[model samples]
Target: MSQQKPPLQNRVDPWGVLHAVQARGTLMGNRGILHDDQNRIVRHWAGKAWLSCVLNPPFEQKRSPFSQGTYSELFFLDEATAFAAGHRPCRSCQRGRYDAFKAGWAAAHAASNPSADAPTWLPIAAIDAVLHAERIGPDRRKRTHPSALAGLPDGTFYAAEGEAWLVWRGQSLRWTFDGYQRADAPPAGDEVAVLTPPSIVTLLRSGFRPSVHPTANLYN
Candidate 1:
């Protein structure tokens, strides 16, 4: 029998859930300091700005995952999973992606801005405010909403049988901490529990493509 791995309290899943899986994570992230001195998760989040970053940040000083820090390090399999977990790109480590996210946001939700010039930039904190509201429900859990499957853009995720599946080019990819597997897409026009936040879903609809694991192309 396979033995259980020790707890790291660092791996994040598509539903914004944390686990201790021993799989490779392609992205790094944080939600402020969430662990105790003994490396146990003591809170859901320490702050509102949940951010997804690169596995190896080019500029930031490297530190041990277990090192005591200003924040607890969180890891995700890919940007798609991270977005499903309500995380946006880290402004510092992923500047280009962050700008694209803002541009996408402006195009998605602020297109109606009366100003013909529109907004060239939207504050990350403002986006965080909206995401915070959408990511958490009144029941204080990962909020879910219903959406038409056929209408969801690629990279969007939905809940089915308690697992998260990514919508990609008319196919559903089963998300795993290791990688994704192609699966039958839902029937045309079926409504499912959308796991990605509404605002971010709109962002995908606006073409802010996220980086996915290489296996995605394998199954594509």
Candidate 2:
């Protein structure tokens, strides 16, 4: 039997030669902060953070910082780096982008893929259709504003956790939460209501204090 030799140790700095003499907080342009754990430059833009994969990061064509454009706060970089930095999609300029990305991501995820039925990409419109089918309504029957819940186009509204989602098709509504966190199941024969970002923000701006964490703040 052959004996394996011990692995050789690298004498060079892990982050790179350029950063050898620099301190930890030294900003290297697009490199962001050099993290020891991942050995990559990590940075947070918008609401998410990410780590750069390569040294010379590519510049994304974005709105000028001084100019007033729709996508001013947008950041463009490798997907791997974006995920590492811990950032989610922007609800405004990146709304469509996030919706598409999330749909494709959910479809490819193993949790979405059940036995016998392969995972499929559902459109945002489909989600609306499915929820409409549920026909949810308030229990009190005294006319009131609907709860804040909206679905993507894929015929399903993904809950906070990926485990379950809401499916609405006209008056037939169903809340699927088999393997995830969920509220009480929708009541039978009730008309369900969905809320969009703009409406939610309008309520918040009007002094509506929400008990839960605010979602869709960027959408408005």
Candidate 3:
């Protein structure tokens, strides 16, 4: 008999790809408890509010990862992938990162607004609402907006030629569960479909650095 794979290994990633790898992720989120009777994540998310989180918490008891539970245990390639999948940093385990992300997000908006009445802070709920709309569409496909590749900061991912590519130091690296591979850079002035949310992109452009896979350095 063939070796059976763990259910979580079969889970689909935010980029609409499936893989089995050992790289640990730093974030977690919920899409309304999407496990089946056999504890497999189904194709569709139950609702909005896809979240980002830290890997583990001291308060929670140890249990089987992705066991039959209220929420499915989804993993990402990195923080950039999590953001691309429309997740923000978790406020509990990743409080400091969350605060920084929130501050960057608010600053991005304030710079764009630049009005005397513009709020200096934005509520998490408000950010989630915007992400919900940007991450998915009425048809449930991953929503993407046209953006210049040069304008995107490092750690962002975009869809091109039906594959996901990462932006890193002026190059586009093809994304994989194991690592990223070298790929063609988008031509100057070309507008490609951006997977990461506009606000998160703004935060990245504003110098909010996100963690990337170690393999990302091989090409650099």
Candidate 4:
């Protein structure tokens, strides 16, 4: 018999669930420590500050071994997928992207503040608090809001007929553990359950373009 591979516990989906999959993605992420010494996932998360990072970040290199940190190392197929999972860019490793994300987030939220002079910059705690409310509800379940499919910006993930789909460049792409596959275009008037949090969706609307798997370009 062929030797079976040990199951890994760090593959994260858009809803923040972890799975054992062979497909390793371009981006790495985490939400505190959820794994035990055996590398088994013991909890959904330990904190609300979920973050997406570059693979094998140098900053992480100085802290501890990859799998020895307080958080279990997680992987995402692309930045878009990571964002949909309620993760923001890691400041230590992805400084440039984090700056852009911070700027975009401030701008997005400021637009709706109904104040004449809203702050253009916000603290990390403030940002995380807003994202935490939108991502996890009091019931510890993924929170979703309704939005018309056509009105959503690119990189906004939504659910329909029990499948996850990414809205990109006027297209809907199905999300798999491996890559994005094309899905049938839904009606312009169809309202769907948006998986990406409202705050992140607003940030996307403010033009914070996420890096998607190259497969997303296949349909174009």
Candidate 5:
């Protein structure tokens, strides 16, 4: 006689009760939640899910230090779920092989006639110019303010109780979000801005802390 496994339960859509669905299981990665039924893996974010037949593999440097396996496929419950999950297109597989694709995208936008405003990053700057070229109709509103992070020197970074960040040599600063929006600028003067990494953010949000006992993530 063969043993039987319990049927997978449906995942409750976090946004609303009416939007729930049965989910088989979940996979973890740098990206968001990857849920699956026995037949196909799906990634879910916000309230959406997408078919994950195509996997955007993680970069070599993105592997875990103490863990065993490399990153598997990027999955989602649906396309809306992926976007709501806050993932853009993968920098590796989907977008013109990443490098060439971004380069061409930047160049094409640069050729168009537009304002002379400069962007902090070249490729992103070019795209911004093209997107904001038109000025007509009602007054537009900006959501998030531009954070220049102009002063933080390269190689120097801050580590706070909440986040981990790296200040690159290219005058760019990258930090993970803690779900809470920061109102003030990073830090003034010589005080270093301690930034927690995304993994840390995920853990903290889940209610674990340094003083509290750590739970083993058996899935890993």
Candidate 6:
């Protein structure tokens, strides 16, 4: 009898790139039920809101990862990937980080808005709504905004030459599951399509540095 091939892994990078890897992730995120009846992830997401969460809760009962569930357990390369994927830190398991993220997000927007009545803090729901629209289009492909590569903050991803490249410490690194490959820097003034949302980009510029993969260090 022919042995059945192993099921495909369901890990996702910040840019919504899927990977079938043996290495485990440190955090978990969700994009609703992207899987079908057979528990296989389809090319499209079933819902709009994506969320970033801790691996496990201290008080709640633990379940196996990727167990049959209402939501798909998407993995990230790091917190940077999670944020870029349009997920905010979980309010329950990651309260401290969540608060910081909220504050930074609010501050970033407030700076850009420059309105006297802008609130100092915005609810998570509002942030999620904006992220939902920015992360994906009506057809579920990754949406991008036009911005200069130099203007985008560290931890942002941009599309160039038909591939996603990560910006880190003033350099562009080609994204790969194994590690990032150093690539030629795009023109500082040229407009490029930014993968990370505008608000999150502001947060990064406002000093909310997300964790990056070790491979990023090689370029620095």
Query: What alpha-carbon RMSD in Å does predicted model 2 have with respect to the real structure?
Result: 20.0
Please identify which of the two predictions, 2 or 5, would achieve the higher lDDT against the true structure. Answer: 5
What are the clashing pairs of model 4? none
* Superposition TM-score, candidate 5 onto the true structure: 0.25
**Candidate 6 lDDT, 95-174, residue by residue in tens:** 99989889888888898889989889877778888888988887777778899776678888887767778888878888
Better of 1 and 2 by TM-score: 1
| Whole-model alpha-carbon lDDT for candidate 2 | 0.27
In order, the Cα lDDT scores of the candidates are 0.84, 0.27, 0.73, 0.84, 0.29, 0.75
Candidates in order: C-alpha RMSD to true structure: 3.0, 20.0, 2.7, 2.3, 18.5, 2.9
TM values, all candidates: 0.90, 0.21, 0.86, 0.91, 0.25, 0.85
Regions of model 6 farther than 4 Å from truth:
1-9, 56-62, 185-189
Best by TM-score: 4
Error of 6 at 97 (Å): 1.1
Per-residue lDDT of model 2, residues 1-220, tens digit only: 9986432121111111122221221111122222334232232112112112221224444423213222122222222112212222333335554565445444444243356564465454443333222322243111113343432222222222222233322222222111112245455233333322222223223332322111212112
Q: Return the lDDT, model 1, position 71.
A: 80
Model 1 C-alpha lDDT per residue in residues 128-182, reported as the tens digit of each score: 9889999999887999989888778999999887778988877888888889887
Preferred candidate (TM-score higher): 2 or 3 = 3
Write the number of the candidate with greater TM-score, choosing between 2 and 5: 5
- Residue range 1-220, candidate 4, lDDT tens digits: 9998765878878877788988888999978888777777888877778899998897556553236557778899898888888999999899999998998888888886749788888899888888889988889998888898767999999987777899989889999889999868555356888989999998888888899999999999
